[model samples]
Target: MSHYYDEHDLSRFGDMGRNAPDLWDKFNDWYQATFQEGSLTGREKALIALGVAHALQCPYCIDAWSQECLEKGSNLDQMTEAVHIAAAIRGGAALVHGVQMRKRNAQLSM
Candidate 1:
């Protein structure tokens, strides 16, 4: 019983497999270079990652980024605030879809 519902057989983040050394090397080169702390401080990066984790609905990333954010001196207040922002954005996004539903209902009701 795999926890993940992907064709890749691995029970994790889409199984960009490291078993293939050459592909792993290339992908790791890009991902590592891209997803690094970059210009942001560690705390800032963790906050952003937490928001993205929430938006993407990745529990593993949420857990990891929350820990990272805490370790990087993000207090509970800050972390929860970040989550609230995520919630607002996600909720707003869903609510915006009601426009489509409303338009469709109006048309179908005609």
Candidate 2:
């Protein structure tokens, strides 16, 4: 079966700069700087990225960040916890939005 997400396509991500070299360069610079060691260690940043990848539901980012987390010395346990944290935040956000729906329904009922 053919899948829409080709793993090989991830390798070509750098090619995104071909048509917009300046923009891509700026983004790349910012992205690289963001991941550098600062208040957080590289491993911590990788774990955070992994959590964000799950929250965003991006297969490419998930795959990349999983490897990055592992390479940066995060074990499966830590990565799993990060994923769970992302899931909890995403689930909570969805549930919190239901308050808006409830308010609208009450307004219509009145």
How many Å off is the CA of 13 in candidate 1? 8.5
Score each candidate by Cα lDDT: 0.80, 0.96
Backbone clash numbers for all candidates listed: 0, 0
Candidate 2 residue lDDT tens string, 3-107: 889888999999999999999999999999999999999999999999999999999999999999989899999999999999999999999999999999999
Q: Point out the worst 10-residue segment of candidate 2 by lDDT.
A: 1-10
Q: Clash pairs of candidate 1?
A: none
**Worst 10-residue stretch by lDDT in candidate 1?**
5-14
lDDT winner: 2
The digit string of per-residue lDDT tens for model 1 on 2-50 reads 5554434424543556567788778878966765777987688789889
| Candidate 2 vs. true structure, TM-score | 0.93
